[model samples]
Target: MSALWRRSDLVRATGGSAHGAWQDVSGVVIDSRAAGPGDLFVALHGPNHDAHAFVGQALAAGAAAALVDRADDHPSLAGLPVDAALLRVADTLKGLERIGVAARARSRARIAAVTGSVGKTSTKEALRHVLAARAATHASAASHNNHWGVPLSLARLPAAARYGVFELGMNHAGEIAALVATVRPHVALITTIAPAHLAFLGSIEAIADAKAEIFDGLEPGGVAVLPADSPQFERLRARAAAAGATIVTFGRSATADCRLLHAVSDLSGSDLSVRLHGRMIDLRIGTPGEHGIANALAVLATVEALGADPVQAGRSLAEVAPAAGRGARVPIRLAGGEALLIDDSYNANPVSMAAGLSVLGRASGRKIAVLGDMLELGPEADRMHAGLLEPIDRQDVDLVFTVGRHMQALHDALDAGRRGGHTASSDKMVPLLREMLRPGDTILVKGSLGSRMKVVVEALTDGEAAGVRPQAN
Candidate 1:
């Protein structure tokens, strides 16, 4: 951005010409709402909308430059500054890819990438907490771990960052490996690959194979942090070994480099006693899930691998908190009294659902589970949902509610005597939920993002916290 970006650079990156005047861009953007001065807005086409339609709005919103698929037909062609750049490409995603790779090349930080069926976002948050207490650390914002997200996060990595964390995610095979190939990580953490994304990967073993691909991007002598209790530990261990990287284990196991000696998960927060090497330290996760405790151990190990103080790193985890719609607790007012709400409505698979349910089970008072369908299960969707009946029954949940097309299967699978009635929409669920509510009831809201279960959580709770859209400020 110091000098005018050469037309040749954009041309070479996307094989497109600077048919319009070239300008030096100071920043890159996707959303027209957040566009700023001297920004280059890339108009990405999506299922429901075309970003090309908003080029004028972006330009009006102080965007100095823009990129689109069709250069000649763009409406803002006449308003350009003589030096303004018009970047045209075959695909806007591909053009963003070029920008991202170029930005990564400018950075000198020690990049660490994490992936697993669960806990990727939480572990990444923990990484930022521990690493930032000592150095200038930049990490993926939320769960920015997909195709476009990976490149976009990599592009946003500041060149002056001392440490970096990238959370890579995939629902299908070859996706993680493709991403890993781009942001080469100094330490790759596989929290644990459980039965997730089964529709695309076929089985848990296949998911393990895909999760092991994190090692594909490791630099020589890089570390692979594995959970000792994970059923797939040996598989990942062999894979990391074959990739010529060392392994740092984390779990309750004695052999682990970073292990949890005691974890007390409660409504306030989790009090964790962790063991690193031969030393033991006390730490607390500012969230209320056992899964959060496990994730903190991974962050603790990552800090040690990065040569930071383990005790200080562990203690710093208190600064980390859950994102909205991911185990974020809210208290709701019922007609009779109040109930605790655990809104984990962002995304769900078997592992995260079970973890959330377990955390809710441990809370005080009567338990109410309002669950929805978990998508992308392929063939095992029904059995998987049905498999929760025993756990719910054993956990002594006092009431049950459900929504979505597939959740009805789980609703019917429950015992007739224990059934509290079911509704396929959270709006329609008001009556039964009202009847079931009590002073000390604890309600857990969970489902895949597509199920819109967060709406159900919103209905129960007062809007004191506003909404879940995150901001950079």
Candidate 2:
């Protein structure tokens, strides 16, 4: 593979001075510990900790060069070799953005940007999977869809790629606007609008307004892929129209450009019949839940918008497995037998929490739900937490275990027979969960990232505990 960035190009892009003999870097990385040979380590200064302290460590780990605002002032680079490659800039963050912008400008690839209240990462990944089968595809790694992450992923974009899929995420109103300005994608997709980040943005309408910002940076004649089922559909469509975008929607709604006709879901996956622009196609996604179907529809809509082969894209949907901490199924080796674990512990809101419960309802064992607080709902946090009782009941979950202060509402709301345990934190809930597990049990674990529910997942999978191992879907 060719170098992602050359020394001369880096100098031109960031308007920085380069020192030392290094000529090229194959990748860009912000985390010093993860930096490796042929990687450009960008030392970013954040509120909590300055990565400048780890410059030496990154270089020692074989990074080709280091991007830094302070080369001489930092004590970490005191005894570095005189020939060590260093790119000095006014600000490392802005420098990274410049490199990203440069990458976007020079690439001839058909680019797509995905942003939503939920399913942005999943939809982005699905697009990558579908497009990669057709041509050279580049996408944001993991959930690299923020200020620094967006640019970092963009800067890492290979010039030879035919398609670029980027996931743009935000916690505030203007965040996506700024990030999308850098992306300027030909296809901009919003998975759905939900009450995510309500604590900061205030109302769900405000949240729609914030998410609709993805259209602000659409390239000329760009296509906007939206959810027809969203209550904010017309609001988003109007915003996309205002941005001069060609609108395409996906959902169960008959008016959707890409519409789901029928779906049958089980614990493992789902089989669905969908109509794309009036052409019906059968798709089987390895990921379960109705939400997975919605994500697949969004992916297919993006595929059509990008002018790729729909047949190939539809076929690729079967290979898309659930990402870790996002509904991956794991098999735990209990003393008596094995139990299934649905790992949805990445992040959560009321919509996702309900979807998880619905998936749990499909399982053929004693259904268990281990929930954590859904953060950032603002004043309605308590009501939202307690509202999950409806889905829990609808899904007929046998036992419910909740973590965090906010989830106490759900715990208090559960009937006596269904309430398993409740704790202030995931750590305290681990032991109580272990004692209750039995053979033929299927457990679904979910919560927001702030709740640290992954701790419970780790505890259950630990060798000292249940000795859990992930089983293929």
Candidate 3:
């Protein structure tokens, strides 16, 4: 939404050419679906499909220009009117990255970068909410936390914004550094070092090390926020200190300058109690997991550490809601009463699975966990899935539905009373789960994106047979 780009500058930067009145260009885009009028649409070439094919659609959407890798002057583009500023790029994705770096370099805002196994979106959203109330803030949209996502978010930054927030993510080494360098934040926050992305990261220590790379772009005196309750708390503090960052901490620790006092959570998530620099603050969060409460505390501390008011930050965080697949709650009306659904199917790993189960346990209805494969765990996959059974009974979750190959381990480990059924695919699992639904039953659906567990949530929420979408939240 920033008017900071110029076509002539892009031509010089990418060694490309522009046609017909591109000098006053302002906006950049990769997705034609989100393009607005006067936007520069860059048709990036992806592995499965070339975006060059979408140039016509971008133009149809009132796009001012299109930069495409149409080397042969694809026939589809020839039909475009002469007024359209159609240009060429050797690679549009790479060109977007170059443009992002230029946008970041030009921004005058105080920037904060967030990354971790979980809570990056919640934390980033919290910061954006807290900061935007006081200043013109720019934040990453959705889970834009990858190589392309980082630049895309940065490119959306306005030149005159007073603050910016980017959620950086990686499943392997060296990815964060590239994005972080482009962001160059005044503050950085690593939510926690959990066992995620192990298929590439190898070990928890390696994960922590990879997470610490968020500081690679910190300006001198930039702050880094870490959770004091995390297992790698000291290691993270040391890593940031080693990287020449000033560390700020939050959690239940007495020494932590920012801390949590209590949380009132049920099937419908939680209301949080926060303590910052000696002032106690009350807040409401849209998630029930203890992890969510802790993450909210972390966000409050980080915002204050970056010079925002802790009180206002805590107040603003109450407005932050969970995304549907992440932690949205839906209630199902049953024959006698109702049922609750915790939809956490957006993503999964060992850490988040346990967190989701914990939230399931706190619900008042008959607790059931609809779990799917947590991919990319490397060797620890089965043990982690089976390990969750320990807390399932302890937390009083009555039934557990395991799906996919990785989840077969959890399926095999379940006892007769708690074991629901193992379905190989989400499509098959949905109808059966639908049949089992009764009033006052609390269902939790969670899995990696590959597992498509959110489909179950969609069916449950939108299924006309089951009553209706839950109002539990």
In the predicted model 1, the residue pairs found to clash are: none
lDDT tens readout by residue for model 1, 173-277: 889999998888889999887787888889888999999999988988899999898888888899999999999999988888888888777775799988888
Alpha-carbon deviation at 181 in model 1, angstroms: 0.9
What are the lDDT scores of the predictions, listed in order?
Answer: 0.79, 0.91, 0.81
TM-score (C-alpha) between model 2 and the true structure: 0.97
Look at candidate 3 and give me any clashing residue pairs: 330-470, 331-470, 338-440
For the record, the alpha-carbon RMSD of candidate 2 to the native fold, in angstroms, is: 2.8
Between prediction 1 and prediction 3, the one with superior lDDT is: 3
Q: Who is ahead in TM-score, 1 or 2?
A: 2
TM-score order of candidates, top first? 2, 3, 1
Most TM-score-accurate candidate: 2
Per-structure clash totals for the candidates: 0, 0, 3
Compute the lDDT of residue 115 as modeled in candidate 1.
Answer: 94
What's the TM-score of each model vs. the native?
0.90, 0.97, 0.93
Q: Runs in model 1 with CA error above 4 Å? A: 1-26, 74-85, 462-473
TM-score for model 3? Answer: 0.93
